[model samples]
Target: MSFPQLLTLLVIALHITGIVVATHAVMHTRTPQGAFAWALGLALLPYVTLLPYLYLGRSHFSGYITLHRSHRQRLSQASEGSELAGLPPSCTRYGALARMLQGTFHPGQQLRLLIDGEATFEAIFDAIAQAERCVLMQFFIFHDDELGRRMQKALLERAAAGVQVLVLFDGIGSHALPRHYVERLRQGGVAIHPFATQRHHNRFQLNFRNHRKIVVVDGWLGFLGGLNVGDEYLGLKPPLAPWRDTHLQMSGPAVMDLQRSFAVDWHWVTGELPPMLPPRPAQGDAYTLIAATGPADPQESCSLYFTVAINAACKRLWLTTPYFVPDQAVMSALRLAVMRGVDVRVLIPSRADHHAVFLASTLHAHDAIEAGIRIYRYQPGFVHQKVILVDDDTASVGSMNLDNRSFRLNFEIGALNVDRAFAADVERMLLDDFGKAVEITGDEYRRARYPRRLAMNVARLFDPIL
Candidate 1:
């Protein structure tokens, strides 16, 4: 065809594409409020409004992506597991998250808190050193610097000892990890899986990332928390300043649940499953359940879990997270709890990783503060850990943050601990953090800077999906 003829065909195809995209956008408006918000944003800024929608609008397709994804995963799961007696059946509690980890991930076990980062690191290294059967390590951000290099050496040492060592890192989160670093791991006979690569969109499963920072040693001892295996965690090299994070060094039967968590992700990344080392389930002090919420969840989201845990608080609630951009329901629960005279306290960072998210967090702080909710800003270092303590009777510690990103999109896991002593420790930790934190006053919230204020408001347009 001639140049002009080709141009005419291209324009026709472009118009058709635009029409299809517009149809999808309109169909995505579920609630009247959503429709109004979309209309308002599109009317105010026609072309630019699509920018935010592009990255966050994948869930609004024609099909029930949730069910379709479930069927696919079921097909994959069926081929792998046949033993019904040994597995917990991954049962669910009534009116809650699907029992994805019931019998298979037994949890009538002991729970131990790995308080200090250095101590946690020591526990992890020691676990690796002792792993006779298998070692599975997965982290969100694994730097190529000293800490990463040291881990490589240790994993190499383990692999050389005829132990099965498998390592997985997020392709995007650990993008800075050197190619040679991975090569060295392979050279030592360790299996390495990049959670997903960047080349293919299938590889770019960014939202459903394995955010649960887990390291299962011999399947009996598990380490999990906000601490990534890096210098900032070690206080060796600081990113956004010296980072302080929380972690769990758990033993007993609960370790199997964590092992199951890693196993699922491991199978997804690599067809072959990693062997988990754990003792057979016996009676123990801690009766626990590890909840994992992800993009495919249709019955419950992590937001639902947070809301339930927060609403369950009778006398006290203590929360700490780097970011605190809660969905309206969460903020309402906090306000209502405060209104009911519960001591609702939240600890957030003064200077977190994302300034815009921080601004967004303050937007909803007013009512809580006014209703007697106490807010604290950790002053010593960046507060990257996400934790919750309720009534000094129960607590949750894990990778989920107090933000919309964690609530809806990202894959996150956290342990729901109902033990009184564990709650006491969590409470004391919150109190200590409060002592170290500065307060965010009402005046500061009212008078946030222009760009931050603008960004928060702009981000609000997609809060339901964020």
Candidate 2:
């Protein structure tokens, strides 16, 4: 065929491919706005949009639902008739969330709030040092920096002591992580792998990330929250230094749930279950539940988890997250909380680790302020903790951010504690944080230069995938 004829045939094929992908987006995209945007771009500019759509258009993780369900059922059956304590009456506020997640809140969980990277890692390392049987660890980002080397040393020591150690990190988040870092761990007898989603037919699906940060030691101690293994998290890096974050340490039956979460991810990656131990006896009086949500879920469990927590608030609802790009349901829940006369406050970082997300968050903060919700920017440094305080009875600390990615795209996990004492600890910590933060108003957005405002508005258009 002539060059002109060949070009014509290729152009026609490209348009047809775009239409086919557009149809998939319309049928599979989680939100109407996302579907419409993808469809419009694919129809009008196939060359420009087709590659991106291939990478990011799908809302669900193919073949993960079946794995998740099978593991969930097996875990449920294994725990049946066990001596797992039931939730206390005061902890029932999160019963709806438990039901939605198909999880149960266990009583007698001892909780410790680990603030900042230093304390969190110290506790985690101490626990690993004491692990007699096995250690399961996962993080969204695992760097090969100072803190990462410390983590590597700790895990290597434990592995040398004949303890089974398994580690998982996100492929994309730790793309820059040195191969030698992982090689050293493997050579030291640690089982390590990246939590990759680009297996088999889903090679183009690079959007879904396993963002949960969890550590389980000997099936008795557990940890989860916002801090990842990096020098920046330790506030050792400049500019965004003095990093702020929160992590939870639990000792009780609840640790088994956290371990189960790690196991599911491990199974997904390695096609084999990691070593797990039976649930331990009650260690304290706190009721705790693990809410693990991701794209494979049939419902938006993470978004619903936030909404339920917000709706359950009668007196106050305070949240802290590095990112503040909430979905419509969460935003509506916040508005309703304000209308109900509840004190709704959100704490976000003033620093911009991600410019686009920060702009979008600024716009969302303004919208929230207009609805009587208070927004605060932490002034000391980046506040990367994901925490929720509902009244005086409930609090949660975890890796789930208050954003679309955490709500619908990423595999996130949080530990909800229904105990006044734990809530009080979170309250006091947040009170100190709030003291350092400045309350923002709609004027912050309204008074911005026209170009900045326009950028924010443009950024908001990408909220779904942000």
Candidate 3:
């Protein structure tokens, strides 16, 4: 065929392909806004939008949903007779959430609040050093920096001591992580793998990230929260230094739940279950449960988790997150909390590790303030902790950010504790953080220069996948 004829045929094929993709987007996209946006782009600009749609458009993960269900069923049967007699009265407040997640609040959990990277790492390292049987560790970002190397050393030592050590990190988040780093761990007898989301039929899907940070030692001790393994997380690197974060250390039956989460992810990656240890007896007085949510869930569990927590608040609801891009349901829950006379406060970072997300968060913060919700910017440094305090008896600390990515796209986990003492510790820590933060009015976004305001509005358009 002549060149002109060939060009015409190719153009027609492209348009047809675009229409087919647009149909898929309309049918499969989670939100109406997202579906509309994808459909419009795919139909109008096939050349530019086709590849991106394939990579990021799908809202559901392929094999994980089936794997998650079967695994959960197996785990449930395995622990049938070991469950606590009943939920504690304090935990009944989150009963709805528990039922939704098909999990129960495990009592007798001993929780320790680890503030900032130093304390978190010290405790994690100490636990690893004492590991007698196995260690299961996972992080979204596993940098090969000072702290990462330190973690590598600790895991290597444990592995050398004949302890089963397994590690998982996100492929995208740690794309820059050196191969030698992983090679050294593997060579040292550690079982390490990347949580590669693009597997089998999901090869084109790269948007779903495993953002959970969890560590389980000997099936008795567990650790999880916002901090990742990186020098910047340790506040050793600058520009956005003095990093602020929170982690939770726990013992008792709850640790088994955390370990279960790690096992599910491990099974997804390696197609085999990791070693499971018998549940230990109660270690303390706290009642806690691990909420693991992701795109594969039948419902948007992460968003619902926040929404339920917000709605349950009667007296006060304070939340801290590095990113503040909450979904409509969560935002609506916050507004309702305000209308119900709940003291609703949100803490975010003043620093911008991600410019687009920060701008979007600023706009959201403005909107929140207008609704009688208080927004504070942590002044000391980037406050990366994801925490929630409800009334005086419930608190949560975990890797789930208050953003669309965490709410609907990423695999995230958090430990919710129903205990006044643990909540008090979180409350005091937040009180100190609030002291260092400055509250912002809606005026901050309203009074911004037109260009900046326009950028923020533009950023808001990407909130679904942000």
Clashes of each: 9, 0, 0
Per-residue lDDT of candidate 2, residues 1-466 (tens digit): 9999999998899899998899999998999999998998888889899998877887766566888987767766765544234545566766677766778888888999999998999999899989999999999999888889999999999999999999999988898999999999999999999987655635577688899999988888889999999999999887888899999999998888888889888988888999889768896978888899988887899999899999999999999999999888999999999999999999999999999999999999999999999999999888899999999989989999998999888999998888999999999999999999999888899899999999999999889889
Which pairs in model 2 have colliding backbones? none
lDDT at residue 52 of model 3 (Cα atoms): 87
lDDT of 1: 0.69
Off by over 4 Å in 1: 1-19, 26-55, 60-108, 197-205, 237-239, 280-284, 449-455, 462-466
Looking at model 3, the pairs that clash are none
Best by lDDT: 3
Error of 2 at 317 (Å): 0.2
Off by over 4 Å in 2: 1-16, 74-86, 201-203
Quick one: ranking by TM-score, best first? Answer: 3, 2, 1
In model 3, where do residues sit more than 4 Å from their true spots?
Answer: 1-14, 75-85, 201-204
**Which is better, 1 or 3, measured by TM-score?**
3
Instruction: Give per-residue lDDT, candidate 2, residue 9.
Output: 95
